[model samples]
Target: MENEVLQDVMLTATILIPILAALVEVLKKAVKLPKNLLPLISVVLGLILGVVSYKFTDLDLVLRLWAGAFAGLAGTGLFEALKTRIGTTK
Candidate 1:
């Protein structure tokens, strides 16, 4: 049961990463934030999304928060990697 729960958190994080990344992109375009602040924004956004999504999953608040943190970091990394690969950096 413990392992399954962890797996669920991992899955939730994985799913949220892309969505968070896209949201960051939208913010990037709509707002004039410094690039250095994007990751921080992503994390906060992820936490908000996770907490608000309680109705969608049975995970406890702590687990959901952990998943959100992971998703936020991963989302930043994924976005950076894709941006670099596509020659869109800076």
Candidate 2:
């Protein structure tokens, strides 16, 4: 359980940093992107993160990678749905 949590932490960090960085760059450069793209972006970012983390960290590569992908999709779906249902747009 602890090990899974640790791996998840590493996975989240790996995925979030680059996504946030890219978002920053997009905003800074005024890059135009399609709407409703955030979810797909998250997935791709998750994949990249999974690969890198598995390469550099002491985690089960296949399991961690799958976990990252699952977490990314489920997380985005859950949060987005919650936000919409709660009528919070911020």
Candidate 3:
């Protein structure tokens, strides 16, 4: 039960970290990031989030990679949604 809960938390972190990173990137204009680099940034952040969240776990390598990819996709989707809703005209 405890292990399941821990895994859930790790998975949530795996998804949320990249999304949060994307949000920060979009909201902050001090750093001039090229728009084309957003996906790369999302993937990298997802990879880092996956590794940090699951490093101590005994999960398979493929599973970890899949989680990271999912995180990247989630971040991209969230970023686009927020951008459309918030109107990034600034």
Candidate 4:
């Protein structure tokens, strides 16, 4: 049904946003962002994504929080994984 399709889209967005954010953060090293701020940025972006997902899907608050947390963690994990793979540790 239409509702199921919308839910799928929202879920996909919820997952991809953080991954994409991580990718951008990793690749945009020339931007010179402070290292300490990256996690905070990811968390805030994840929270915003969760709010948008909730607005679109009407999902419960707990689920939204989980989505946000997962997204934040995913961003950090992805960044670390990429960094390891690229051998760019500080």
Which candidate ranks first by TM-score, i.e. highest? 1
The collision pairs in model 2 are none
Number of clashing pairs per prediction, in order: 0, 0, 0, 0
What lDDT is obtained when candidate 4 is compared to the true structure?
Answer: 0.65
**Model 2 lDDT on a 0 to 1 scale:** 0.58
Tens digits of lDDT, candidate 3, 1-90: 768755854676565655656554764465778777777777776766666656555655555655665677677767676665455464
Error of 3 at 5 (Å): 15
The lDDT per prediction is 0.90, 0.58, 0.64, 0.65
In terms of lDDT, which candidate is strongest?
1
Ranking by lDDT: 1, 4, 3, 2
| TM-score, cand. 1 | 0.89
Clashing pairs in 4: none
How does candidate 3 score on lDDT?
0.64
Model 3, stretches more than 4 Å misplaced?
A: 1-14, 17-30, 55-58, 85-90
Q: Write the per-residue lDDT of candidate 4 for residues 8-86, one digit (tens) a residue.
A: 5457556656565755476456587777777777777676666667655666665565566567767776776655535
* Candidate 2 segments exceeding 4 Å error: 1-30, 74-90
Best of the two (1, 3) by lDDT: 1
What is the Cα-based TM-score of model 3? 0.58
Candidate 3 scores a C-alpha RMSD against the true structure in Å of 5.3
For residues 5-84, what per-residue lDDT tens digits would candidate 1 score against the true structure?
99999998998999999999999999999999999999999998788768878999988998898999999999888764
Please give the range of 10 consecutive residues that has the lowest summed lDDT in model 4: 81-90
